[model samples]
Target chain A: MSQDQYFIAVDWGSTRLRAFLCKHSLNANIELVARNNGPGVTKVSDSFEKTLFDCIEPWTTEYGRLPIYLAGQIGSSIGWRETEYLPCPISPEQVASKCLIFEELGHEISILPGLSCLLPNQHYDLMRGEELQVLGWLNQRPENRKGQHLICLPGTHTKWVFVNNGQIIMFKTAMTGELYDILVNHSILIQNKTASFDQAAFDQGAKFTLQSEAGSFVHGLFSVRSKQLFSQITGQQSTSYLSGLLIGSDVRAAINANEWNVDSLDKIALIGAPHLSKSFARVLELEGYKTEICKLTQTTLAGFSSVFRATESSLITTS
Target chain B: MSQDQYFIAVDWGSTRLRAFLCKHSLNANIELVARNNGPGVTKVSDSFEKTLFDCIEPWTTEYGRLPIYLAGQIGSSIGWRETEYLPCPISPEQVASKCLIFEELGHEISILPGLSCLLPNQHYDLMRGEELQVLGWLNQRPENRKGQHLICLPGTHTKWVFVNNGQIIMFKTAMTGELYDILVNHSILIQNKTASFDQAAFDQGAKFTLQSEAGSFVHGLFSVRSKQLFSQITGQQSTSYLSGLLIGSDVRAAINANEWNVDSLDKIALIGAPHLSKSFARVLELEGYKTEICKLTQTTLAGFSSVFRATESSLITTS
Candidate 1:
């Protein structure tokens, strides 16, 4: 075997699959040397080995036979193989063991286990790829881990995780992104032509939703177009208003559930696209919550790096 | 034809078509003489006459070319030949004037005009079939018509109407039913085994929703099943919790936009399926609002009756 070290990390999600190639050495920087798109584990046939090999064909010349660490839905029931979830308030070791191992391509491949929490006599929240992101966030700011933090990872099913002292205490999932899509695409609220986030509308919607009754958000949505057509509320603003109503209601519910403390506003980090994350952060700020935005790609990548490092360390110790 | 003195009213909604025949006497006892399903105006082909004729076939024989009044989407651009919408805070004359007349199968048919509210510098809110229901409710309870009332008609797109002095001041729509359907049937939240609503879960969801931040409800839904499975929360309760979250959020939004004073709860009437209306009313009651259940079928029938009576009186006077 060559002395040169090679490592790989993958971020597999519901709709998209991404892989990163890295060479690990003392004082060496992790690089994204290869990338490909194919039928994710969820979409392809059961030939998992063939699928992985086909996707990584281009990188094989340089680092195809590297130890690979995978994260995200690849461990879901429909993914490469079903990996058991680690109960919440877990450590790195728990996640590592729960990881499912796949042997092929003359290299070791492991899928990271998702984190989950079972609140006594209540509902549980589960997360997959995001654990790597959390791990990344923690790895980047180890000292900041002293206090509790709420990380908002926005997507089809956004996740709001509560982490305390390096442990994921609990988490919650919201269908904010999906709802937005449905309302804009499938329902009657499709008047707005632009795909961009409407900040003004979002702010208004968020404000309205925050103060509204527990079950009143839907009724308020009709006004989005009506306000634009008659009330002279601009379509863009109406869109923003809608965003506000949904996100504001979501935040309000999370707050009410006592998932996190209001005083910890400074600890809220939004990990998603800049515009959306900023919009949510703005709403939080208006409500007197200190908020921060974490670049989505960077956070995800960092998360993958952390897992890769951990896996490499384990392999070295064992070897 | 024998002068039996019978009047016919049709309540044509998005999904269903229903007709009622009433004897033109003092009591004017209304009976559901005929019913048929066809494409709603929105979905109907240009062969509109065929669809309409099919639905009214059962009642037409008994009524013998009676004065027929139509309400709902029949007044839309696609329904029964484009009827104009009457601006809100309107009277019976306004609704009558906006009616579009169509001759069909030797019967004088007049479709009721929908209501529209155009606020200065804003888009307008419009309603079709439900206006008849509103009129019926107003006519039935003249004594209780002095103050402001919020009438909730829950369905595919739930409507919240604010009425004062027998005129609809404003209204809003929530796609709650549609959202519920999508979540339960299409979204990732779908679980194999069906679950019933649990009051405890609903109450918790409602309470949590009432306090949630804007836009969090969409994100919060995914945890329902997972919460149920791993956390010992029953699936049924999780479903209820989701319902509570959605419905509670909708109600909250309506209350906020209308700036409704909950101190006078008795003025709110919920119209829908008995169970759903009651559930919504319960949520309102918990919020210290006075709520009453409005039988959805009766209200729709009464609205149709009121319009039918109005149409008949006009024909008699004109002839």
Candidate 2:
């Protein structure tokens, strides 16, 4: 008989729902079984329960009442259930302990709450999908749960998370990707003719972030437009230059972070897509930091597993 | 004999053409007789001649064979005709001397060439309408042109110009207003529920730009969103905070400018709308700089007058 059982991890976000069906081995190794995606909370709106089951029914029919764990926007107020955000300096175990349980599909459903940090100004900084990735990074290797580590998750909203001894201490989010998107797509800074990447232009932009006299990013962005008008850079090249400038600014901000110095962040773990990570990796390398890339899905699944282990044994039962 | 003659001054830009009908007194002062506006280059596109005539027909009919002087984007490639940018350090006289002439409506029409400054990086920073305003500020008082002065014109794109001895030395453009518009409208930053201005929130935003360690303007902009999400700042307050942040960054960047020290720019001439100028003046005052708001239409008319004086009598006479 197979010593493998099925479990589902859903990283439900604002725009999309990504569900992974995995095989849990007797030795605690989780292997991907199948992956399914559906419309996120945005598209399904008030019909999330219906939409989620509609996409994951095939896996449930084959696996027969497997335990399901959810994270990210799914737990947001606009999502399936409004779970309260757990204040920071909390551990992965605490996150798992607080996962809200819902009775549906004749099975147990656990939803993870996001992490929140109160700034000195009393403004709260938060992350929905990233908390899992942080936990997953640690779960990938128990040794990773030790010591201090800088974790970067690059996406539409790039986050620089600080963790110490397996607990998420605090972190800041940079709207680097979103600004790049809006400027390139909407602002006159770039007339992006093609979506192709240019390493040189991006490098130039990255270099600009290092120049303090170049003015604040608000002042610096005009260089793209000026360069284009002066023929210093082409329309096609502006895209990469702009990307480098924004990403470089993000890195610069992280460097200016109070949590740790540059040497302390010599090696940082990055959880993101390979393509996006490559751009960030280039900037980090230039800024004298070593980056280690971890697949987002792997970290996400690993995160769910870590939370599962933290929960009561009585909560999840064998089928 | 009547000591006044009517003329038309049009501040033509990409989006709008604002024409001022002024009665020129014998003493060189221009009084507003009437005002007219029409769709700019973008709206009329290839039908520039038709649009130009349509908007100016009323003025032409009232003031027979009026000498029409134009400044700004109407001289660009997308405008009525393509006029090359006059390289900087060139005087108002030179701009007027270089004005492109066209015969229309049995009268002479003059289009002033925009000013272009080649940066140290060889990136050309160009200005269309602001050039006239700078010269007009100088023209307002010939003594004002005897020394170096800083001039700021706030708009969709803010321009900071340095004038020395009746000539524009150099200028830099910041996309602050445009960035604010895009973020509030398109980006994830603000869900601004109302259009009202909150001075306190704006002050807070402006204050953020002064923190060097807060990282670049790119890093700071994210706080608006965080503040909104945390409920530390209301959606209504975000619009003002964002404005303050962007304007503050502009001031900070200007303070950090290499052109001249902050003390050297104690009193900068500002040419913009009253409402926009008030916001800029507030930030400047907070930063220990004095701002003098000049009427835009006045500077424009005075600029046209300066340009007109520079033009040869033979060129402006009816054919």
Candidate 3:
């Protein structure tokens, strides 16, 4: 703990609100000081301020009036203040400028705007928190910014983004995680199965999906039940099989899109939870795409700090 | 209506236990006399006998130990009697011959065995109640025994069957309706919506799915939310879009399998609720396939009667 607390960073989404007390070290790195998670936007309802303040109470009190930068659903139409989405190819400057700035209880805070894009894939798409995380990830790798790169942020809504020359060109989302959650929890196929990870089952599911006769996701899904019927799959392994099936489908679609050269798309960075990232990493590798696993929180913090610094510099110049 | 009461046919399943008091018409028809639905096997738990008796008390008291023909989950491992599965290429006789026979309260009861098969698509498959319904449909049209027909029984689990000359050669199940239920009821995607049938939305969803980038069910699902985001699809239309996307995907996969000649597949039979049957009919029609819609309950009665008659004829010969 050589460095002191610098600022407060929050990644607030629909299900949960997480806050990180960070330190801007001498080497210009985001060192984590402390963390707190509270009810997310959906649960907080009218008590958004109460929940946000309740969790960051200790940190806020210690830092006095330090700046707080937030991202994700906190700026959604249902969040504390709704912010307009800046269309891609959006730079970090566009995001910072569009951030909704407001004050509460003698405190200064800004919520970043989300990104919307007209995908080349004949569909329109948008992402809230993950876009900022992508920005955070890009800010850390300036050397690799000159060329085109593909980044996948695996989550409830897995995003497949095309980044060209430091700007997000376009992105599309695949509802893999959310679908997996519903199928395992509410579906008759695997509702009785637990969420325990089984590597073999998962690998089998992914492999089956990849080799699936072209364009048959709905059919492959029903295999979960049939596999169980033929005693090829057990209840415990059903969940993993589902996970592999969904993740493998998601990856296969991206590969088929011809957006990424699987053989040459070296190091498609995975920025998400370690467990989820590893699952995605395995599936991508099996399909001949190299992957670099990165922590979600780190990238989110880096993104928040990057925008906060840009705003800070502008303020200094204006004064 | 001209026929007199003859036998009791029960379509016993996981969630609903339906008993039909049928009449053996002189014209070789099974006329409906009365019907009752009790707590399904899943809800009744181990007290299956109590629930069944409670619902059909009036009929049993009047008929005095009539023969009961049971099908579906009533004969599953969790049902009152665990019956064996008749392998595919099975005829009505095979199903009737393997019926789990027993006596209860001076009453003779027969539970028809389910169908299991290794699909031509290389997946193991099984069906309980739907197989019985298919048998009923086939029994009504003896002429259909000469050729192959594609039959779709749409419901919670939609079944696409390939029947050849009075035998069910093979079939595949798509979790379309069930997936639709969970998504509209539980998934964060569109959980707050009602099940109002939106004709336009459904048509749009089904059509959109038909044109979806090959092999990407997971990606297209996320578009339901994106379409809403882009204001191209409203909340009222979300359910239909989901329905269309799923049904379209299900139908497309079957068509692309190289197993069926879509242009010459001639008159695909649809057996299910009128509303859902029509939805599948519309989608299949849009893809240039002919669909013959039939009532599920009617087909179930015909199927049960066909088997019951076979058993009755054998009893007389044995005596």
Candidate 4:
């Protein structure tokens, strides 16, 4: 009987780093062994390797230096090692094939390539960490491989990916979360960033944007300030309203750009942290698009497991 | 003989303070006698009176304690003295009637109240300094006193004013300029804030926004970063492109919000600094709307002159 294989998966972005130790069972099920967090690529002072080691050395001592799969901004030029971006219409297998595998301090590391695409409107779009989540989502069900699907990963740079027959055909990125962060923290619209989320205000903002005649996102944003000034919404409600406006605008634009009828498309899967994914779902559902929220960790782990297993099987056969 | 009475027209905003010593001509013409600049309201450490005296004290010494007409954010709650906002459907004479006139030391100071309006869509919009510009635009000719006209004052908080029969009926404010400032200075979209303006790239960005089906400003903003990553636009071109995108989006949103058909509307009067007014004019003309660019200083002087002359006449009658 074959013993279970072991590996490490790291999701390192601009702000934070998360590493997970996993065991791939004989039945192909992936079990989490341990998880650790560290500073993001930008925050690493001594070296990325030292930071990664600090987080994963404990895992390696318990289980020998297993193979590693790193995803997200960690593969960008500023990350541990610069990796190429895979062009669109790429399957998870194709992404695995393009992985930048290297040896560093007796550990074999594989960094997943980000995805870039020329949108239908001739605009170039890109995504890094979200691709793995898309892969994990696609890996979830056998049927997910054979249909036209839309997956949204909402975060600082929210990604909306289109899949056809197991390949991510094209995708778009909306800077909704980044905009919200900056507008709240940097702009004059909202003075309080930690205000409680008001559902009624958020829904009003989303509905206003969705029902707008020309669907002007910029115009609707100003309403956040105006509504507050008019006493129509309070200081506590302004942040939520702004959030709803941006997400609603994003959904409307994506639908317009892709020419997707909300009622006709398959459910658009949302993959991210629970709060953000639920926010996108709220706006999407408000616009009448069926949505399914997927956890970021689950998707990332599944994606890394699939790639790691594939690479291991290929290595074993060759040896 | 009225002897061409003189007044100091002060446009004090959050960032800068400008004081223009003017002579109200016997024939209702206004001539600039002297002009000075000082730190804005926010920068006043000792007192607004001290700052105002430092900038215009020489002028007052030379011109003999001239009445001071203050406009802009200088009249807001944070300025020297808080002034109420005059409700819309107000004429220049009506704005003058609501002015908060007071005496300090040896000079009379009148703070022009900002304008507030409930838009057709029921959003509250506010403007302080732009009201003087609008009043000046209306005071330019007798014909401006009759019929309907659209006046656009493009600045940090751009105001789209609708005038009917020489009265300020209602207006909307778009945070386009403020958005541009924050994005360039604080956001991740552009790193170099001092990039030169590239007209071609700007036009391209403007055209892209204008032609977009959904007019989504948030979605279009991400294109700035993506286009640069893909080598579609250079860093130098990125700022200009962002500028175009925002201005174009503003124009589009304003048109949409007001339910304006570009071809059917009268020439839109763009009143502000020459460069910003020209930018608005370029986009407005591109959208097939006839535009007239008006100088901010001239408009302010005229606005202040009109309000000052009216107030002086009322004071004379009352005396």
Candidate 5:
């Protein structure tokens, strides 16, 4: 096996840290060797290095000092090392160029730069980890690199990226996931906090936003409370309803901000965990767009591997 | 004093309880004799009656078992007594007729019914205490009873009420205040949550929602964090910025749902405490509508007095 075949990708977000032991196989395609998760950036009690090594000690002992690429909030100000946010319109190479490379504890490390864009409305949108998923998605298929694509990465901060010819031109973030978290856990709108997924309730909530007077999000939020009050919807179904409402609002925001007519758009690529990505895909399809769902980890690994290929020799020599 | 002259008006919401001791003066206008505050419906560990009497024992002792009128969350299912919600278009008389009246501890207690409306979009909008503000605002001036009026009651659930010829034609509720509370207290968007108001930051936030694509509220919320990340806004200014963004969205929701042209609307009556009312009034005026701010205590008193006059004899007789 080539020395460059072995590497690791770490996704350290606010709540959890996922590390993938990956290797370029004889076929020259990346394959996962093992996977482990530890505390997130916020949850680490000891140093991040200690927490990371604890999770990957067995792999490191077996493989011997592999190059590691870290993404997400792990590269944020609160993370091990704060990386610069590269501005869009940017390609994977441009993002790789801005990586914060350093040597630590007999390991070569590259902290990926986050992405930022000043939207047309003079609003600044920033994303740390989702850029890797976008890059990976684009790298996964040749067709993805050739055309205009609107990619929706659904998470705590959902990023709607407008891509043209493999570069992210601009993107917007919606606080849909975060809002849902607080509302369900804190607000009076939801009484039954069951994690039960009710498809009909979800669709109904989505339709409520679709039919509501355009951008009546603040207004529609109250229905989560009033609908319960009037027995229009039960407490059991409220969580799903609230989810549908917010996701629908997010979809509407992207379409309205980008001025993308649903009928005219060819396809939207949704990148995230299966549940959230599928939810977004369902709503987008309802709005008259074709959608393809991509697993978050796969795309993220692809993105890191592609970038690793380009920047490997330089990072290794410096370390 | 004439037996009919003395009565008490109470506004009991989820957070606080306020009661006004009032009487009809020689001029036949209602005047407040004294005021007292107590635990809200939610904060009452003891019986609500005990909590009420604890605050107003002095007045009740001096006044000798006067008639009492109650409004707000105190009239909901979780309140002291669950009153029905009267559907719009409803007049104050219609509201009074639906009051839950009974004798309790030798006092004539009448719990007011809340108002509900099926909006044009088929969403059910409901309000408890704010109906009193709408009734009081219209009763305060003869002209208010004669034409179309938009009344905004800003609170945890802000109510946008449309009154036509002395009845509430329709209304909608926005979870702006509640959303603000959660975001400030729980979300990652705000860091420094000083309650200090920054006018410039507020205007910037308000204009952000205004200039962005109509209904881009979900998208705009993330800017509260990203703007800070980019140093476009500071931590201290975040609370005000968030307030402006949510209030601006609330206003936009009303405008879009009602399809009201900013230039065509004559005036919007903002009924709340001075601080919140003024903030809303300033935004409405900026949007080209003249605004009048009404004090909450005064409006609640006026609304109770109006309804009291209609139902006083029946309630007094029953007790």
Candidate 6:
């Protein structure tokens, strides 16, 4: 029974931290038993031990001797400790050794090493929890995982990842959410105070960029605010125009960059908060791209579970 | 002495108010005789009479009386009384309206009617003082002004004006400066500590937006601060990157629009503060365009002078 015990999984990010306790069966139905707030290693200032114990207290009380698995920034140098990155094209066995083990309060905790990809002479790119999510996605849909896919994980810094054969090849980061916050809170475009997504503004701004002359974004931005202030553009519609300008310009740039082939629209998957993910999917659809929205929480859960299972399997094989 | 007075030009913008006493002789020597503050109508809370006198105080003290001419927003509804717009294809004589009479002040102030271009069923575009600069450029070198020209006047709200055949055709406005201020001061891009321009960062940011795959600008903005906070990007370079992003993007948009293509690059003129003007000119030059930096103060003086002379000529002809 002790050997058959389940493992805990954690997903800690910049703003929020989540933990899950799961028992993996042979059928791979991971049952969630306990959950708690682990001290977000990134957010709290106290000792790492205190933070970790605080989060694990409830789970530990419920399931006294469960081994813990952690992902995300907890593996960062500043988080629990300096856990080195696992080089890309890594196997499940390599990932298990990459997990750092720490014994505390009569319980064992292990943090997963993030994945990194290096180009010939360029600096390497790294991903923490996201890699696990990709792994989880692949585990669940193994048949759909063979081809090159563009995975857009949209948040503060939206990451557009190119995954080939279950490994991240290359990725670009976009600060879309941050920009939206700044423009809305600080820029003169604050005339549109509506918090809800202004679809009209999004459509107008999007269309404007699509039909825009080669380099008209600069002028178009001014019009977004000025038209509203001068009453030439309605407040509600201005948001759409602004959105269009941003999204349209982005799309235009992306199209020009050949980041995704024009002919390969079906290979895009969006992972983000519902609204933004849906919005981007809609825009891609309008541009004749077949898009899919990957459920964010589900991906996180699956990712953590897969990492945990992979680690347990490796331990069993080593024993 | 009265006949010796050649020209009177006034620069009335959102911030400062000034009047120039110029000798309309062979050399066209321009002298700044009077300057004042908070009379820009938008800033002034006092009576228009008081604001005008405050500005005229220096000239009234020095020359007692002179043929006074004015340009800029002073001719707007909130200005020296409402002056209507003069439709485009208008020559110097056609656009010059009668000076507004202030019986109590005992001086004739002829406020120039700003030039406007009607877009048939579409809304009209208007300009006040810049028309004079365009006219001055035209008048100063009639031979060099045969084809299409794009004059970029950078300020709070930068104007990109398209002029063809001595007639103002169309113009677009950009809030480049304002955006820069907001981003630097209020947005997440705030350096917290003052930092100078980082050419490398600027170049990187510029290149980022210039790329075909550059998605929405909002997405790119987060990297400005995030890179700094995460120590991935240097603090000093962030400002430069931001400046480059905004300016570069603006330039890209302007170039893309290609609103003023006259089959060659010899006709584009950039007018603004020396540094910003030069920055813009440099970027345009890189894009295989001929760009000239028009000294902003000098251009404003010339613009004011041109409008003054045109108004005086009209007064004389009408009288």
Residue B139 CA displacement from its true place in model 4, Å: 0.5
| Residue lDDT tens for model 4, A243-293 | 888888888877776434445566988898898889888888876778888
Q: What lDDT is reached at residue A297 by model 2?
A: 85
Pitting candidate 1 against candidate 6, the one with the higher lDDT is 1
Rank by lDDT, highest first. Answer: 5, 4, 3, 2, 1, 6
Tens digits of per-residue lDDT, candidate 2, A1-319, equal 2577678889998888999998877687888889999888778844777787888899888878877889888898778888877899998888888889987968789898988886554446888878999998988887788888898899989888888888888888888888888887898787665759989999988887665464457767888877777777788899999999889888887877655665764588888988788899899999778999899888888887777666734355442
Q: Model 1: how far is A120 from its true place, Å?
A: 9.2
- The runs of at least 3 residues in candidate 2 whose Cα sits more than 4 Å from the true structure, single-residue gaps closed, are A1-5, A120-123, A212-215, A312-319, B1-3, B212-214, B312-319
Model 1 CAPRI quality: acceptable
Give the per-residue lDDT digits (tens) of candidate 1, residues A33-127.
66666666667674867777766666776654777777888888778777777888876555665667777758788988888876542556788
Q: What is the lDDT of residue A99 in candidate 6?
A: 79
TM-scores for the candidates: 0.84, 0.94, 0.93, 0.96, 0.96, 0.83
Instruction: Looking at model 3 chain A, report the run of 10 residues with the lowest lDDT sum.
Output: A257-266
Root-mean-square deviation of Cα positions for candidate 5 versus the true structure, in angstroms: 2.2
For residues B1-319, write the lDDT of model 3, one tens digit per residue. 2245478888888888899998886667788999988777888855777777777789889877788889989988889989887788888777788888998877798988888888665677788888887888889887767688888899888888888889898887788888888888877668447757788888888877788677778888888888888888888788888888999998888787655665666788999989889988999899888899998888989998888778886886888
Query: lDDT tens string, model 2, B188-213?
Result: 77765466988899998988766545
Candidate 4 colliding pairs: none
Model 1 vs. true fold: TM: 0.84
| Model 1 residue B306 lDDT score | 63
- Clashing residue pairs, backbone N/CA/C < 3 A, model 2: none
Interface root mean square deviation of every model, in Å? 4.1, 2.4, 1.4, 1.8, 1.1, 4.6
DockQ of 6: 0.42
